[model samples]
Target: MSEYRSLEDKLNYQFNDEQLLGLALTHRSFSNVNNERLEFLGDSILNYVISLAIFQRFDSASEGELSRMRSSLVRKETLAEIGRELDIGELIKFGIGERKSGGINRSSILADAVESIFGGILVDGGFLNASSVITRVFNKRLEKLSSDDFMKDPKSLLQEKLQDMGEPPPDYIIISTKGKSPHEVFEVACISRVLKKEARAEGASKRKAEQKAARIALTEMDRDR
Candidate 1:
């Protein structure tokens, strides 16, 4: 519990029931009384909160556009990135086997833990508190989001940008693979000869790795302009 003080500080929200927080961090691999139920509840709350936020924020957006924006915000990759930002990986309790297999950094586990924490907050404080926390955590992301950005995926956007500039489309190549079947991690590189830029990222699947790499390359290109 003492060790979680840093995490609490990062969240800017303290738990009245430390046990709820503990349960939120416990993976099924660690205990039968794990965070799955909380994750389920949190998933619902997250969707609702983000939906309402975007609805009010993007008053001009169509329903389909709002849905796409919400999906982008609540996706597993985004949640896992949030978990990493909050340092939730260190707090997750996994079974010996899972720990040995590097479960802490696994995106699925990190994303689940984040949702469970939201669920824990809801149980401890109530909907208002959970909404507050969710909004606070997602505020920056929401602020930076644009209707045009959510309309296209990173790959599509990158390709379109290159095409508009008369440059060739970027190429995605799998650079490396680790682990075994069903749990393999792939490293992919997004390369663009015209821009002389390359970005690499790792993910649970080749597609995800390619998307991440493309996102990174896009960011770098944006920075250069």
Candidate 2:
């Protein structure tokens, strides 16, 4: 035994199928092994678990309200935040190159690893058991999410701020689009109203590109203030 006690202590999941835990911790960059399938399953599992939590947590909330709340909980940022709380990044086994390149600190990578591990737990135990574990991990978060006023869309907020500043509304310009078919990268720039400062970002989708650009704008504005 390599003394896998650290993660078990962290997650409170004593794995009967310890290999599943190992598989979950293994990143694809490590080899031909794929965490993709587990990620897919885990994504669905997490949604269901979170959905139930939302439904029960908010009796007066409507379906749409619950959906929005659930969406907030399951976002990449939220998942990454939870992953950080678990210190899951420290436990992830990455390829030598990836480890050196700071892959463990990447939010997206950490989020995927957490989801894969959650799926592995589901496979090792029944759905109810898995749900129990997931719920426990997320209970505090669910309560916090329920209490907080949901954040407005960043892009929309950015636009509103620009308008209030008496500047022309923000505009997005597509600078470049590249990469293979399924993973095309989009680089976009957000043109600020008064400052004329252009901030750019790259993402896999147009919406993501827009959001990234907005985030850049927000950052630039804060520095000047």
- List lDDT for all candidates, in order: 0.88, 0.79
Query: Which ranges of candidate 1 are over 4 A from the true structure?
Result: 151-225
The per-prediction CA RMSD against the true structure, in angstroms, equals: 14.7, 13.0
lDDT per residue, candidate 1, 80-179, as tens digits? 9999999999889999999999999999999999999999999999999999999999999999989986656778878987897799999888889999
TM for every model, in the order presented, reads: 0.68, 0.65
Model 2 RMSD vs true structure:
13.0
lDDT of 2: 0.79
